[model samples]
Target: MVDWIIFLPACFALNMACGPSNLLAMTHGAKCGVPFAQKAAIARLIVFVPMIAASALGLGLLLTASPFVFGIAKAIGAAYLIWLGIALWRSAKTLKSEEFLDKSVSMKIAFRTEALLAISNPKAILTFAAFFPQFVILDAYWQSYAMLGAAFLIMEAIAIFAYALGGSVASTFAADKIPVFQRISGAMMCVFGTLLLMAS
Candidate 1:
């Protein structure tokens, strides 16, 4: 069995390999700038707390037991992703300048956006259900799970911040191409949403 020291870094690397959420984070980071974008990422993680807890507490099994229930959740998540992608596509040309930063993206908006992307991810929930057991020793399950969750959060946070830094840099240099960046990001999100649906 792999120790946490070995497992967590592997998990972190997997997270950083680029996925829908990571793409969204990178795009949002460019849109909102760094530390603020990192907050949005963390906020999204906060929103997932309930699901994480549920997975650890056996609700994951319960939910999985009912195909109908899981299907509904999966559908809702797919819909939300598609909807969010459309919204991003529609707002591809949102004006951004120095003064605009003041009214740029309210924390509320950022939190909601990130939360939607985070929470609606069925893959995340399923991954938790499947993967957590590998690291868990039921003899000391609760404690082990707690440690695992902490590692997930820590690694995820670090990855988000790193992606945000990359975004901030791109935004700084190609500030004039904000609209182009938004369009590309929006298109990618839409593709991701479609991919999710197809995965079902």
Candidate 2:
């Protein structure tokens, strides 16, 4: 049996952690719209389903033991983040308040970006492997694992909504400073990418 009493709060904390993925949600929300951002966020959740399953199947342990694989994964993720940041930074120059939500970034691009980011983060697999086992019942392993995965996805959705809403609100609050918001978001993403690269 899963321990809901202990699991729920921990799940919520991980879901709401200030991370690059959540930042991407906020950035998308601010740049496009809440609805668009929410839709884009779905891509990550879709990818995470397989990730959680892989963790349950012990791929997470493989990643933990394989520093080469982990390094490669982080490098790819970091490069993409840096490129995305640079693109956003450049786009900010031409972003108009009236057409902010109608800018160059397409739905397809957003979905791909979200999916790639989720897939390339090996740490996510480690997180699931390390965290989920505590609540999982060995007698009902698959069932409990599936339940925890479901709970995680639910919390992730909630966190996505919250971050996207925050970005939308911030966009509204700084309606006149859209360019500034873009620049800040871009810079933050770059910093995140750099930090990811630096992480050992």
What C-alpha lDDT values do all the predictions have?
Answer: 0.76, 0.86
Which pairs clash inside model 2?
A: none
* Clashing residue pairs for model 1: none
- Per-residue alpha-carbon lDDT of candidate 2 for residues 96-117, written as tens digits (9 for 90 to 100): 8767855456999899889988
TM-score of candidate 2 against the unseen true structure: 0.93
What C-alpha lDDT, on a 0 to 100 scale, does residue 115 get in candidate 1?
86
Q: For candidate 1, what's the RMSD?
A: 2.2
In angstroms, how far off is 83's CA in candidate 2?
Answer: 1.5
Q: Which runs of model 1 end up more than 4 angstroms from their true locations? A: 93-103
Candidate 2, position 115, lDDT = 91
Candidate 2: regions farther than 4 A off: 103-105
- Residue 76 of candidate 1: its Cα lDDT? 75
Candidate 1 per-residue C-alpha lDDT over 1-200 given as tens digits, one digit per residue, 9 for 90 to 100? 33777777677876786776887778767877777888778877796677778899888877777888878777777787778777767776565544323437788887787888787777778767877778887788888887887778888888898888887788888887766776777777777777877774
